[model samples]
Target: MAGREEQLLAIRIAETLSRAAEAERHYVKIIEGSSSDELEDPNNDDLHDAEELLAHRTRTAFRECQMLAERLHMPDFAKDIRKKLKAYGSDAKLTSLTYSSTAGEQYCPALADAWGFYEPMAAVALGGAVTGLSVLETMLRNTAKIIEQAKTTPDRETQVRDAVFGILDSHSWTRAGKLRLQRALKHTNRT
Candidate 1:
């Protein structure tokens, strides 16, 4: 009988393989929807769409295989995936931007204008613009400083930033106050 760790590894491998197979199916569907002759046309929208679909599927497959390789302690296999992705002109390194759209679902004019640049001063300013002016300003300044100075992993930084944003969004600030904060957040690129 397989040991517990072995069993878990096997399960992970199976799941990853399943996802890769599903991605392959989607790739096939995209190819089948477009004729080869049409794909040869430089101005064909279908050709561009097919290329985009294929690239997405390739990236998805690479991620699944790379993850499985890492789980199985196969560093070489992961390296191979990275090489393949590079050959295909895709970035193998993963970041938040890779998996998410630039702007979130709810549109903020300030954020849109700034392309989501964050400024610590915005939060500090928000503190003084509200009813709990002094207290909020002090708290925001402290929190912002902590976030900026903390030596943490990229994922941890993302988590902290998300939490801060959640608090700001959920707080009972006046509409104008919120707008001002959003504008501040967008305008300045200070860390």
Candidate 2:
């Protein structure tokens, strides 16, 4: 029975990872498609439309990632991930994650690796965001900081920075990014 339970847990973990991957892919598609557009074109409705779609998809992906992470028993992964992210700096990484292709490729692997390391906090943060918890904004800002840290630091800092970036850049919580922002504002309003 214990062996069976372990197998079940493993299966659940795999499924959650798969879902997170799918979310990342969707985010990638949005990013790739957005960049392919002609920025100089006067009739750039497609770009705008694509941006909107990307935002929507990002949110959906984030919510799903949060759900899956919660299922995997790593509840506080997002929060811890946020803490690690704040250690790095948020703006630099956020710009890179959204704008730089080379940065994306280089940093994405680190971000993904970080996800594995800090899955529990991430899961909790994501869950709180999805469920409309009061703490969502604080979580998002912290996550943004984590992404930044992953980008600019060196050595061990770099490792943690990359992991944080990977988790943010991944499709796992693209949409959650915006939701987190909203939550942050909501949190401010209450205080």
TM-score top scorer: 1
User: Candidates' lDDT values, in order?
Assistant: 0.46, 0.46
RMSD (Å) of each candidate, 1 decimal = 19.7, 22.4
What range of 10 consecutive residues in model 2 has the weakest lDDT sum? 90-99
Instruction: Report the lDDT tens digits of candidate 1 across residue range 1-191.
Output: 22344345444444444543444345445445667776467887654554454445445545555554565456785676667556545321211012126533222121111111112212322323335555446656776554565543346544665545556666765768766765665565355
Candidate 1: segments with Cα more than 4 A from true spot: 1-43, 90-191
Candidate 1 has an lDDT of 0.46
| Residue 171 of model 2, lDDT score | 38
The residue-by-residue lDDT of candidate 2 on 43-100, one tens digit each, is 7765445444433433333344444444555468535544544553432332123344
- Collision pairs in model 1: none
Model 2 CA lDDT for position 25 = 55
